[model samples]
Target: MKHPSVIIFFLLSYVCCFAQEHTNKEVDSLYKEDQFYAGITYNLLGKIPEDVSQSGFSLGFHLGFIKDMPINKNRNVAIGLGLGFSANSYNQNLLINKDDLGNTTYTVIEDTGTYTKNKFSSHLIELPIEFRWRTSTATDYNFWRIYTGFKLGYVLTHRTKYIGDLGKIRYSNIEDFNNFQYGLTLSAGYNTWNLFLYYALNPIFSSDARLNGSEIDMNAVKIGLIFYIL
Candidate 1:
């Protein structure tokens, strides 16, 4: 769900029901200096034109390491910094193109069996920074947590593929693809299964990219399950 109410509801419920129980000493022991995170998310295009729509399921994966730095004596709150890899695929009816003049464009086309397996995928090297909070003791493996952060990603690879018609065709590392991306992220869970959300602040294509003479700007939104090991 795109609505923020869903996120607020869970967070508020968790805090109200459990946050008051932790003692100062117990909270102090909650933070771990190092953590590993993994996530599997469903991807969506947040602002695509009504005429253009997703055709198939889009899946995304993220794996990262974070080093936590306690900011208070209680250690229930901390800041995290880390590096990782991210990759995602989108199967949609929109197709990427270049006009005769070399201007990049996104065109909505019919799938009539002329082409199959149409999709676009990208991989990135990323740095994540987070502010974390939790209710836990040193020995507690299960805890309530709210982690919010931003991640900056540099494009590592990009590909577009189509199989059918004239034959299999693929484009790799298209010049019009955005090389840099940054997004806001949030994760909250009682234990290993966290609800994760990522909203990209940048568009998928360069500023100059257009469709039918209109600028084409599409940002990504992801929501799903995330796990953590500390």
Candidate 2:
């Protein structure tokens, strides 16, 4: 899930609530610090009609920061948020064919066509704010924490591109992604660092009969390290 937006919203709301309920000094003393981490991860995209080529993996890495605090007087649960960035894309080489009717659509070349790679890469701004429920508390030296939540964000780049038989092409906000950028993130790793999977409830790209559009699937799978400072 690309979640900077959701996390930011939740964080702002949390801060506002905190300011109304407790003193700034008390909030600072309890919140403590934040942590940062970076590592390699894979991006799995459902892909869009930019299908002038074949689709496959374009490797990348992710870097993130996290912060958390307890909820109310009950230390058993914590509210946390994180923001991260991942370099991701899809590469596809397709077979372009022109029909007698002047329609330029692609079909299998029966083992005779060549592969032209259509590559796309973008830096994702992610934010995940979570309400974590812990079963056990950590000692001074050991921290054992588990949490889950949702995230939301928009594609911050020309995240969609075409590099197949057609010349290089890029898309603006108009028809890119579902236009509703949000995904569900479930995670279980460790403190300041954990493995997570983000699932999108909406298609990254749109599907319509008009605009010469094709069905482009754009959900993704990401595995990376997470860190929380507080």
Candidate 3:
């Protein structure tokens, strides 16, 4: 599979989760630690035509491990770095097409009965760096945390799926997608129920992508829940 990296990444996380178990005192004394994080997010296009707006739930997910380096004596403040995999899907009315001249275009598909489950998905391998704050002491299992970070991602795969008058159809390895993506992220909550936020800084598609002679500069935003395990 093209995404063997994702499987390998998760297997590493599963191993790390079991390899480390620390008492309260040990946790407090440790200058550095690592954690596994997983999250599910709702995704939406930041910019899109009104006629081509999202038609259904757009979901995304991420999983990975982060090495935390304590920056303060209290161990409540730290910096983190990690590698992860992320996948995002957007369900919308827009259809991707290539013109006779061989240029990619986004067109609004207005016939609802003619098309169902029009969605595009992309998978990425990402590196994340974050500033972390927590109220946990060595013994505390339930604590407040706020983590804000930046992520750089390289696309591994891109595909589109739809059910239409022609029948169920799928296309993979879209060529016009941007291969590199960078974004900002934030997660804040108490204990295990963290609210996650992600905003893409660059367009999902390359500048060559066009709709009606205008550039299609759509970006993605995600919001949802994140869970961290140590």
Candidate 4:
């Protein structure tokens, strides 16, 4: 038989090794989820002028990274703050032109048949803040999620193009556009397919942009799908 001290040493060594392995498992369980995302949306105009109407497909593309901060032990509830980029286009009958004095003019095209292409596009850098809740665990890949948030964006570049009887009019960086845009956003769904919506809280154009002596206050609404990745 082995000496009594030798057996005690072996038993002590086994206990220490088991305890260390258990501690490593606990550390590994503290994990985070859903750090990256990408989405596409069908863009719409709201609160538009009486004569203005959408003609073509207006779409938006978005992608971003979010910092997720879980508040509870289960990690099912979290706050997310992210930086994103978005490119959006609005196709409508409202005309954007420049006068002789280099001033901007806004007009509604009564006859849609006159124009082949008329739209304005905007590129923005966005900040999104969300309150996130989900049926997610550290290791679960498929779960339900509901994320509601507010998004603020600053226009990086803007352009207007018209091709028709007007003989191809194009302009860039119109001063009438509001450089800062903000909105409310919601995203919810199960697993890979998620529904997303954004409703603008402010107008796309500044108050100086007027139509028929009234401020042309038009908001934006976006509906689409958003996908999240680990």
Candidate 5:
């Protein structure tokens, strides 16, 4: 027979192993979902001036991470704050030009057939704040969600390009563009497929940026899909 001390040591080791395994099997009661996200959108322009119109398909892409804070005990309702980046392009008949004297000009291209491509693109760093409601549980992966939020963005860079009969014209970091942009956003869906919409509350250009003596007060409207991942 073994000594009593040796037997006690074996018993203690077995108990410790069992406890460790049991702890590993236990699930976390406070789990969060959809903390990381990526999305793509179809961009549209609103409040266009006369003879100004969009042409080709304008696109926007976004990716972000949100800090999910559960408001209630169930963790189904939460507030989310996040930082993200977005790249957007608007393909339209509006032409932006700068002269040698550093003066900028905005023109409406009446003849769409003359230009093969005319577009302005912007890259932004964004801050998103959201009110989120979902039918999700800690163990459930598939659930319905509705998230509404406000997003504020600062332009990191912007460029305008035109390719057509006129010539290949390009401008970078136009000073006339509004450096800050804000919008309302909505995202709703089940599981992985979510519909996303964004409507800008302010114009893309400042009041000083004018077309034919009128302020080119155009806002952006985006509709598309957003995917969230754990």
Candidate 6:
């Protein structure tokens, strides 16, 4: 599903719920404060970019999900709290920094490098509850849906191991999350299904081996489909 589609669904759901609220006064009055939703969501994890630019994506993969949420749908907004599990990895051998003190000297070493292959696998339990503002109750005129929210995730395991070329490779010792992860997400979509993209603004690792702050910067862009089975 695309980013825009997610927003459209949110808007459509919001409008439908609101309209129903007025006609079904008894149901609305007796309505439970929340709704329970569980479904499978597939995600594409792009290559961890080296620079601040999010434009380049050389490779990506799929992730699985299991979500359980208590939702509240109202006129202006609705909130969804979900728990999901995903497995994703990316590899690049050519960009491994090799000069030891390479960045400090500003000089290129003479064939003094090796292309290292490694993968970072994550086991994340995510809780993302988003709030959306609907412009209208009618889907025909409601072509816009805007959302902003936060997601809290705990890292169960983070592993980075080297592969290929037996004698020439050395492995890295990864640091675990200090405790938990807290980040923000923004998206827009339309049409009752999922037409939206999600952006994560958080570092994947809680600690870096370099001791500089974040050992690696993890910014992700995921576009997918979202709908309900039940």
> By lDDT, who's the top model here?
5
Q: Over 4 Å off in model 4, which ranges?
A: 1-27
The per-residue C-alpha lDDT of model 1 at residue 54 equals 83
Candidate 1 global lDDT: 0.77
lDDT of 2 at 184: 76
Per-residue CA lDDT of candidate 3, range 114-230, in tens?
887788899899999999999876666667899999999999989888788757756787777899999999999887578999999999988777777778888989999877877
- How many clashes would you count in candidate 3? 0
| Model 2 Cα lDDT, one tens digit per residue, 53-172 | 334655545556667677755465777777876555555443333357844443332222333445545556778677776543432212455667777765676344554444564544
lDDT of each: 0.77, 0.51, 0.80, 0.84, 0.86, 0.41
Best by TM-score: 5
Once superposed on the true structure, which residue ranges of model 1 sit more than 4 Å away at CA?
1-34, 98-105
True-vs-predicted CA distance for residue 48, candidate 6, Å: 7.8
lDDT of 5 by residue, 1-230 (tens): 02422443454344334422322234569988778777778999999898988988898877778999999999999999999888888999988988789899988888898989999999899999999999998767778999999999999988899999889999998888999999999999998778999999999999989998999999999999887876
Instruction: Tell me the lDDT of candidate 4.
Output: 0.84
RMSD to the hidden true structure, all candidates: 8.3, 9.2, 3.8, 16.5, 15.2, 9.6
Each prediction's number of clashing residue pairs: 0, 21, 0, 0, 0, 16
Which stretches in model 5 have alpha-carbon errors above 4 Å? 1-26
When summed lDDT is taken over every stretch of 10 residues in candidate 3, the lowest stretch is 19-28
TM-score of each: 0.82, 0.59, 0.85, 0.87, 0.88, 0.49
TM-score of 6: 0.49
Q: Which is the better candidate, 3 or 4, if ranked by lDDT?
A: 4
TM match of model 1 to true structure = 0.82
Cα error, candidate 6, residue 197 (Å): 3.9
